[model samples]
Target: MSIKNKVISTLALSGAVLAFSAAVSAQDATPSTMEKTEKVPKRGGHGDKHKMGGRRGMMHGIELSEAQKTQLKAIHEANKPSESAMSEMRELRMAKRAGTLTADQQTRFAAIKAERKSKHAAVKAQIDSILTADQKQQIETRKVEMKQKMQERRELRKQRKANQTETAKPVAG
Candidate 1:
């Protein structure tokens, strides 16, 4: 997991998914509050994808050449699914969390994931075509660095969660 991957995963979990569910659950509340809570933030665009070669926050101090930046932008655009597919994915994710999915829904969701995975693989191939041999090797090294960072974050989160539970408990003495 690169830093970009980590950020995307975190945002999907804490931002988009949570916001939608929160809005839906609060539907019966006051109209003004509901309206404010229901607005879903727009997804990232050219700025997010092309800015710093999609590793804006992740790869500190490393900069891509003009050619590399252009190729990365093209690769990102090519890999992005259609708007309809993204909407369907969002709906399926919300439904999965809201309740048990029927057999058909489960099958459809699985197919969508497969399609997205295929697109990702194609994009990766395109990116590799643009990179120099040394850059490709550097990416592999970065993957290892990212994996270690991810594990450390997970452990830290677990410890924080445990401490919260302990503090919340009342002493029996």
Candidate 2:
């Protein structure tokens, strides 16, 4: 082959090789066509509690009677904050986020929060009254177990982070 032909052939081969590599890299960077879409749970949403079997699940396990369930539901509904209150809370949250809450609004917001907390405590006490001693004991046991599991997860995360940091550190020559 002529020197010009050899050079042209070599250039074409290098171009093909580079194109192949680029295609592979692009494929690796992009998600696959069959990849499942991840559903991110909304923060502070009602559905979040029951997904992992929260308080309701614990109560269910305790086998509360129909009357108890009905009473609990009624208590929840009766104590539920009004739409106007929710809207006000939302507005206050927005104002707080924007750093624009006035002194009066701040005081009002704190009062609203305190009122909500009291209402929650009251509902909880009412619910406890309905629950049997055995049921409450079971619920407490579950809570303790859950707390321990959470602590274990936290320790594992810390250990993983420490391992990552150690691995990331450069070795001195």
**Which 10 successive residues of model 2 have the least lDDT summed?**
48-57
lDDT value for model 2: 0.86
Model 1 agreement with the true structure over 32-75: per-residue lDDT tens digits:
87688896767764455545345543333445688887877777
Q: How accurate is candidate 1 locally (lDDT)?
A: 0.79
Strongest candidate by lDDT: 2
Best by TM-score: 2
Clashes per candidate (backbone, < 3 Å):
0, 0
After superposition of all CA atoms, the RMSD between model 2 and the true structure is 6.7
lDDT of each: 0.79, 0.86
